[model samples]
Target: MMRVGIDIGGTKTQAVALADSGEIAASVTLPTMRGEDAVLATTTSSVVALAATAGRELGEFSSIGIGIPGHVDRVGGRVRNAVNLGVRSLELGPALRERFGIPVEIDNDVTAAAAGAAHLMSLSGTVAFLNLGTGLAAGIVVDGVAWRGQAGAAGEIGHLPVDPHGLECPCGQRGCLETIASGAGLRRAWPAGGAHPGRGLVRAMESGDADARRAFEGLVSGAAGCVRILALSIDPQTIVIGGGLSRLGEPLRQALGATLREWSGTSPFIADLKLPERVQFLPENTPAAAVGAALVSRT
Candidate 1:
């Protein structure tokens, strides 16, 4: 039987059917609708589309797993505080299970991405996934299992206050890492870049836009801080950069590595950690969260 995995993002929803051999057999993407009802409907539609693409009935799927942004109650299969999706609270797992007559699992999107990255990259030991999307967050995996931590807030590094007088975060914190490294941060720093600031950042910088350069540098510096924090705290074997902003690709990787190397020049301990060599970027266009949700469902 195939396992179905869905990744519900702020802008899009993607679903995939994984064959028994663990390869994706079918996949579908749809625009995600906001609100509890609309989000649920979007998820259902994704599954339906995936089933049709796979040429199988829904019953043929053994289980369904979902990766969504929010405060997920993994045990209870509930989600709340998903501001991007406009979901104040939702009983997503129960609703989906009832509709499909199968087991459903819910997890944080970043966590699912970590799992998917680990699986897809064939990584072992400790792996950390740093998500640089609209927001900054991280997820850790040891061996094949994810470490969600107590209260499921383990990798919420975005809220960690870094500057006492920096811009205020929606989380009510000043100078949060998210305020420096995330897409939201970029928008604030380069308001002229419009809603999706990261998209045109390189072009703007190449055209000698000082504001864009400053914003991009800030993102790199903030991201380097996150890597330092991860290295000091979890000391993971590999730190994988994933998320929308990761599409910045080689330039992002080179900038991050250079920053880490510069920091290493200041401290022997950091130099010994080989932080620059440990960094990696997720392959573009990989549906890591969806694949990860399917992998998580198996557990």
Candidate 2:
């Protein structure tokens, strides 16, 4: 059987047709149009187009799963808010189902990504996901299921207090972890609270540029602190880091590794466990949430 999956990001929407075996038979991307029906419209059109390219009919697929960036009301299939999306109160699942006559499942994107990544890793125990793209969020898989807390606020690490009196987060918190540790966070600490020159700052860190190095260093303390805090609570066997910043490679890796030693306390419960998994960035064409969303449909 084949399923269609869509990952709707702030800037782009990606669709993939996957065999039940998890092979990508076809894929396509389109600029995301937020608000109104435009975003869902683009997704429906793209999925149909991709299915046709794969030599399959859209009706033949079992399901379409969407990983939304905002607060998804699972029961209602409505996206309530995602500040970056600038679109809210949209009925995605029903809208897509109504248009295409196929079952649609909408989920929080990070949660989907976490589920897919955990499965790909063959992670049997617990897996915690830290998503660091244009935004900061996390998702945890206990056993084989994502632990979505009450009101769906679990794994939202961006609003954690990296700075109590620092930048104001959209979540109405002061000094959110995202304000200092996300891509935008790095940009803010750059000379002008903006982006570094050239195409990608993480790549600059690879080139041994001084400013880029500083930006990463700035992230380590906060980022590592997060790991420690997570250790205290979740104690996940693996911590998977995704999104743009993980592309920084070893500079980012080494910094966090070193800080973990300092930040991880010596209490037996905290100290005696196996060394946590180092941060591993998922592949460019990764087991993303959309894939997980579709995978969920199969289950």
Candidate 3:
């Protein structure tokens, strides 16, 4: 059976029809509109258009899944307090399931991405998937299933209290890791503050830009802290990086690896073992969260 997956982001929404073995039969993209109704309408229109393009009908799809932008109550099928979508406590699964006449799922986008990463790296006993974009988050997979923790707040490393007295985060915390390492954080780190790739600032560091280098150094410091913490706790066999910054290729990997090397020293938690050689580089990366949303049925 075909599955329709939709991913709603801050600037765009994407939907894909997935068949066996990850073949994409149909796909759609729509500019994210300003309101909830507009977002749904735009998505439906795109689905219809894609159906026409494929010479089929949307009714052929067996299930629909939506990867939403906030903490998701997966069991309740609700999107809880999405700041980007201007939505709070929206019952996306019920609404869409009722409308589409099929099972519908609403899950956090990062969770979806993590699932995709896990499937892509099938050798995993345990795995970590990290997305560094406009925001930062991660997903954990163990024995091929996501571990979402009791509060459905797993992989929320951003709010993990990296600095007790550093800076106040919009998430109402002092010096959360996201406040120091995300795209917004990198942008804020710039003194000139003109326009730069918030995600690519690490590469900008290599270019010998003094301010950019300093900013990225700070990012490495925070990132090292994150890696160390996760390494001690999760002990993942593979760690995959997705999102805007992962496109930097080897430079980003090497720099981050260097930091990891430093952080690994003299720590009984790490014990001089090398990090797994499982960092994947998907050249033409999919918006995995969108594709993973589509894969909910398979999961």
TM-score of each: 0.97, 0.86, 0.87
* Between candidates 2 and 3, the TM-score winner: 3
Model 3 scores a TM of: 0.87
Indicate the residue-level lDDT of 211 in model 3. 83
lDDT of each: 0.92, 0.73, 0.71
> Candidate 3, 93: how far from true, in Å?
2.0
Kindly list the per-residue Cα lDDT of model 3 for residues 226-278, writing each as its tens digit: 66566667767776777665665676677778767665665644545465354
List runs of model 1 lying over 4 Å from the truth.
none
lDDT (tens digit, per residue) of candidate 1 on 1-299: 99999999999999999998889999999999999999999998999899999999988999999999988988788999999999999999999999999999999999999998998899999999999999999998899688999878888898999889889999887999999899999999999899888789999998999999999999999999999999999999999999988888778888998999998999999999999878889999999999999889878
Q: Positional deviation of 130 in candidate 1, in angstroms?
A: 0.4
lDDT winner: 1
Ranking by lDDT: 1, 2, 3
Q: How many Å off is the CA of 280 in candidate 1?
A: 0.8
243 Cα displacement, candidate 3 (Å): 2.0
Q: Estimate, for each residue in 1-299, the C-alpha lDDT of model 2 and write its tens digit.
A: 68888888877888888786877788888888867577768887878788778888777787888887877877677887766666767888888888878788888898888877877776667777788776778888787687788878787877788666788876688988887777777776665335532236666667777786676776777677566656667778887877666676666677777766554465455445433455565765674776767766544
Q: Model 2 Cα RMSD, Å?
A: 2.9
